[model samples]
Target: MNQNEAVQQNSKPRRVSKKKGKALNNPPVKRLLLPTVVYLIIATQIPFIVTIYYSFQEWNLMRPDKGVTFTWFTNFIKALSAPSFYEVAMNTLILTTSVLMICFVCGLLLALLMNRNFVGKGIVRTMFISPFFVMPTVSGIIWKTMVYNPSFGFSAYFANVFGVAPYDWFTQNPLLAVIFIISWMWIPFFMLILLAGLQSLPMELIEAAQLDGANRLQQFFNVTIPHLVRYIEVVVLLGLMFILQVFGEIYVTTSGGPGFASTNLSFLVYRTGFQSWDVGGASAIGVITVILTIVMMLLMFKVLRRMFKEEQA
Candidate 1:
């Protein structure tokens, strides 16, 4: 009996080792993973390769007889040097920054408000979330037609009540109009993330803070803000990424301008490729935008990593 027990103990390690070996060399997992990886590579690489190839060649759809000529860095140089590019870049920055700031503040406030138990809380939360579920094109149209239209719209109706003339929002402040529409749509998304973070806070910590004579504002600044740093980082980075590619709202509402007043980098790319028929230049712009986005993400990741390390330390 003692010899049999010794053999059983000895066999356990061997069995575990065999299982580990099988896990490492699992045929089914390898088969599944290999095709998924190949599919991703093909899907991403094909468009990227095509875009890079086109960026160095001059190709105008309107003048196909001219033929595609290799211009090397000419398209990139032209896109960078164009005066309108600066305006569009600046507009993009302004729109993204404005929307992020407004949405973050409003979303945080709403999240804090909703964290408390209140009557009709479910209904209010549902209403808040509804805007985010609306299609972007439909949202843009609704804002343009129902809210911002100078004539026979909500703005005009409100103006009559207040004894003021109706203002054409898109014409006078196209960027602001677009920003407002986007912020309204995205605030709910931010709120949901922030509310989840708020809900996850340990009640003991909050109660302890209150017992230590921390008022609501002090507790918020001292306790709440520290706990939410990671969540805030997520919201900002993802929000910036999506906002940089804002096109539908601009396309539907402003069409990049009365005169390039609201044109962002994405909209500029669209206009260059389709409207100007300069595929090479548009491709160059597209590549540059992708590179810039990658650089920004890298910087953000590095900063966040350092912050996390410091916190851990």
Candidate 2:
């Protein structure tokens, strides 16, 4: 080829490459996306930063006359040593663990049942999922007034018909009562997720298992549960995130009351900040809670990662 023609050909390709690169740059999407990122950072991080700052200082709104003081580590130490701290921690552990266990097991069973082709399946599924849509506050109030109330509730009426007094569930077994309420509210959530997982499972693999003389139970244990590890992990992590912040139910039903019987970390923080007006102490608790939650998430992610690797292998 002539030198001038070759140069023109090379220059044309470069021009086209530049045009393609320009077309790939999505400035409008970036412009819309970056502001959202900035807004989220500002909205979430500012309060977190403020809480951390106050955690190191002594500021009790209730005792303003005593004046604000910078007390490093005192609030943390006090929170640790407080007589009710351990009770609150235990309550938190029990509440989270019990609710998760109940929800997971019940959810799996319900998902399995719903997976089958049966009459009225649509109605059953709609009814099963309805509770999950109810607001937590409303759920708590319904349980408190319509179910558990000893004076004029369903249980009371039933007991009256049998000539026996209704047992006061909240007063007698506060933690268990809270667990039941929370579990009822959360089970359908897990059920929906697990049902989706079950439906998405490969039918060919299931048929192969059946051909290999694997019964339903064996296939479920060996094939189904293994396939659902990732889904379970998703449910667990999301459940923990929401469960750790449980407040409305406790607020409506127990008020963390009759002592620290049902008071978890979140309730304790609320009580400290708003009720007791110990802003610094509450901030310290909030910081500790954030740390604990982060640590828990990291551990769970590590375990799930290992499980994922094993499944792949």
Candidate 3:
């Protein structure tokens, strides 16, 4: 065979191999991902766009005769100008913050406890996680009637034993009641995440810290906490997102009363659109809520990232 003919044969095999390599590397990834991307945009973004469109128009279901009219920013202005808006905003902040803090502390403690070996540990962990599996509305009802009820409930029974009046939780402390109920439901979620982080932690580090004259608290604060920083960030951010949108607990327990005392932005949207029949106002409030959530999450992410960098440093 001629040298050129042999070289051409080798070159052809190399070219074929290159094509195979490229196919493996690319793997039709875009084709596989396009359906999911399209699905998400249709499910989430399209509705949001429709909401934004409606927010710019005045549409009251009660006054269908007047029909929808483009009023630019009037709906936003009206929604923002309402006195209850600020109160509801504050309630949302307070509820989310309180729940996140409560759940974090409780979850960390539970995770620490669960990380230890003990008899029936699996059963104990299952019991702890059971609340998270319960439906939100069911959890609300359970707390409202079984735990927080002023009469013939745990509160009343305990109050009787203590020789004090059963506190009307939903009436006098509606926001607090909502906070407690939400914390109860979400604490397990944080526990599972934090527990996973704890389990993944290297025991050698703890032993090394101990050899260096570190106590349990010192090791936890210095070694364990720093190690679990990423997990903590994930738990806090996820908790913030879900807790901020809390509606079921408030609805079942306080009904956003006494007179909007326990109402958060989510419940406010429901009340606006459903009760008041003001679609434009509700859409505007929803848009404001989405904006606020995005801003808050971005700020939080920046802070967490900075903290993570510091931990790495």
lDDT of each: 0.89, 0.89, 0.90
Stretches off by above 4 angstroms in model 3 are 1-26, 303-313
- Candidate 1 regions with alpha-carbon error over 4 angstroms: 1-29, 303-313
Residue 228, model 1, lDDT: 91
Residue-pair clashes, model 2? 0
lDDT of 2 by residue, 1-313 (tens): 3567667756654554545676544336677799989998899988999999999999999887988899999999999999898999889989998999999999999999899999998899999999888998999999999989999988898999999979898889999999999999889999999999999999998999999999989999999999998789889888988987899999999999769999999999999999999999999999988887787788797867876665544
Better of 2 and 3 by lDDT: 3
TM-score, each model?
A: 0.88, 0.88, 0.89
CA error at residue 161 for candidate 1, angstroms: 1.5
Of the candidates shown, which would achieve the greatest TM-score relative to the real structure?
3
lDDT of 2 at 50: 94
Candidate 1, residues 73-103, lDDT tens digits: the string is: 9999999999998999899889988999998
For candidate 1, the lDDT comes to 0.89
By lDDT, the best candidate is: 3
Tens-digit per-residue lDDT, 1-313, candidate 3: 3567667756654554554687765557699999999999999999999999999999999999999999999998998898999999999999888889999999999999999999999899899999998888999999999989899889999999999999999888999988888888999999999999999999899999999999988998999999998899888888887888998887888889999899999999999999999999999999999999998888897968776666544
